[model samples]
Target chain A: MIEFTIWDILRNLLLAARWTVVLSLVSFLGGGIVGALLLFLRIGGNRLSTAFTKYYVEFFQGTPLLMQLFLAFFGLGLFGINVPAWLAAGIALILWTAAFLTEIWRGSVESVVRGQWEASASLGMGYVQQMRYVILPQALTVAIPPTVGFSVQVVKGTALTSIIGFVELSKAGTVVTNATFQPFTVYGLVALIYFALCWPLSKSSQILERKLNVAHRNH
Target chain B: MSLIEITDVRKSFGQTEVLKGIDLDVKPGEVIAVIGKSGSGKSTLLRCINGLETIDGGSISVAGAQLLPDEAHLKALRLKVGMIFQQFNLFPHLTAGGNVILSQTVVKKTPKREAEAMARKMLERVGLAEKFDAYPDELSGGQQQRVAIARALAMQPIALLCDEVTSALDPELVAEVLAVVRELAAEGMTLLMVTHEMKFARDVCSRVVFMHQGRVHEIGRPEEVFARPKTPELRQFLGVQ
Candidate 1:
């Protein structure tokens, strides 16, 4: 066995952190676009649309994210489809993120009172026009805090992707721990990096929530 | 020709009948006040006329077009029938001028500059020209209602429906909103108001409709309904000893 230095461990984990960050961004942006579509279907579509969105939310939210990653990585192989670890992990994270996001957005849309819909309808606005002009502008105010808050979850969720050999920060930490026999030091740094990434977003979301509440109160 | 005509109209929610076979007509420049106790269907009748509430059992024609359940026709009908709500449902995200200009630009397809000018004029009419940029929550109940009236009038509708427009206002503020309505009445904008303000109804209404238990119990001039009250239900409703 060779002697190991702290610099070696730190530099390796730091390089892996880039992949974690990239994965989180890809999953978040993909999830947001898909979540928006699910939210629109949940609100404006007929009964079948509502049912489909409901089941989609339940399936992802009810299962553990680790299990979802396992399924995405291994389950597809059963069907003769060999997906790379990174693609499997990213796809699973996107699906899971979309589930929670769709539910979060649905709540925001529903919080707009029935009277706003009536007022828009009374203006001779069709359903799409009403949603575009009246309902969405109001719903966006309620949507921002949750959406920002949800980003933290997406960041934290990237840890689970490492279980499928994605070579992200957590996986890199495990490799360094096994090689250097420094579990405490390596894991501690990993925790700190995650905190550095997520803490500011958490604080900013709380601040935004308070500001929106104050704006509403003043109104 | 009558500006609005409703014949044998009916509406129900689940098993509860809210509007039971109603008939009425409004000629040009008529101001009709509909009064009844809570759950008496006065608001329902007004909503039906504007195609906001679908009628279960009859015909409503506004400005010579027969009102149907088709979305396109309803949109056409809405352009000619403005409505004000008791809650003063101005868009909270929008400034007062934004609320007023929305229908003008979106439905009427009026040019932006023209819509703003018209919104300004209507706001001036409602005594809210100074509050053109204020949000709904920033305004008092009375001011919001005035802005709501301005929002409705910006459409330049042939007829206006007010559903208890002042019921949410403070007693002190009620007169200010009613004053706006009275001014609109005097300017020959055909008006149908659902109100609990008896004195305002007695003074400004060209006709009074007394509704009770989902039906029209009486309809005539304000003096006839307030003074004579032909039906026992109307007499008891007006608290005639």
Candidate 2:
């Protein structure tokens, strides 16, 4: 029976917070690139491409993220494939982030008026050119608020990684709670760390959304 | 040979035939205005000419390039025929100059500096010299339409198709956009406009074609078409004797 000092618990969770940040960045960036490609395929004219992307999005979005972690961790091991908790969690989070990101981006892109497509075409831009030069730029303005907002979800999502035995903030909380038998104090610290990371992003996203709406309205 | 030609062109989406049988021709530098009621296929006719809307039957040739359903040829044909829309449709992310310069740099492959200079001049010509750095959302409807016109002119297409280019403008703003079209026509830019501005059609267009039910109801010099229309449909459509 060891009594864990608040300072000791805080230090351990602070160290674990680094992994949470790293995982969030890795998952967000990986998901962004893959999501962009998925969005391109979704809009491009191939029926099969669209169908495949649709299923990929729906499969990830429809399931609980915790189950995805379980499947990624245990399901792979059952199939004669061994993956560390870190790798399994990262993969599942990346897939989950990509699904939601693609949908967010697709809605933003589609929100561009049909007339914009016609205008770009009339300027002699092919499909790719139109998207790159005309449509995406406008859509990006509309896309940013939601995208920044979604990053908070990515940060919060890192908590589920601990369920797969990845030693992140939540798991550190569990460890400290077991050793110190102070669930209230340990969990409060964990919640505080999350609030610290998420609150700024949430506020910034709100500010950005307001500014964009004002700019759009003034225009 | 006509600079552009459409013979018995037909188009349909799902079960609705948008362009039943359209025939049109424009000599080099000719300005033809196609005017009709909503759903009268005025815009569809312009889109068909630029290969934006593929015709189900017949043919369209622009600047000697024949338009077909094949995507490759459609892109090629679109290059020779520029268009402007009722909505300015400028890219919201890009500045006014960026919108005009993109086609020049990417499709035309002009050097960056030259493309930028040309874009500036086009914007200036459209009375938006100071607004070149502004985004579409930052400008007024008239300004956006002017940028669109400048964007189209930057390509130097053989013909410019304007589909209700001023229809979305405040009545007061319409003249500013029409003034640019008038200026372009004066500079020998072959133009085809689908507009509801009866006065602009009578004043600026060399020929006025009245479309009814996806077919050309009448085509003649502006004076004849507007003053002494031959068909009852034309007179009724025009609401003039």
Each candidate's DockQ score against the native complex? 0.68, 0.64
The digit string of per-residue lDDT tens for model 1 on A158-214 reads 998888899999999999999999999999999988999899989999999999877
The parts of candidate 2 lying over 4 Å away from their true place are: none
Q: What is the overall TM-score of model 1 with all chains considered together?
A: 0.98
Can you write out model 2's per-residue Cα lDDT over A61-112, one digit (the tens) per residue?
9999999999999999998999999999999999899999999999999988
Q: Which residue pairs clash within candidate 2?
A: none
Query: For every model in order, what is the iRMS?
Result: 1.8, 2.0
Among all candidates shown, the one with the greatest lDDT: 1
Candidate with the greatest DockQ versus the true structure: 1
TM-score of each prediction: 0.98, 0.95
Which ten residues in a row are the worst by lDDT in model 2 chain A?
A210-219
Fnat, 2 decimals, each candidate: 0.68, 0.80
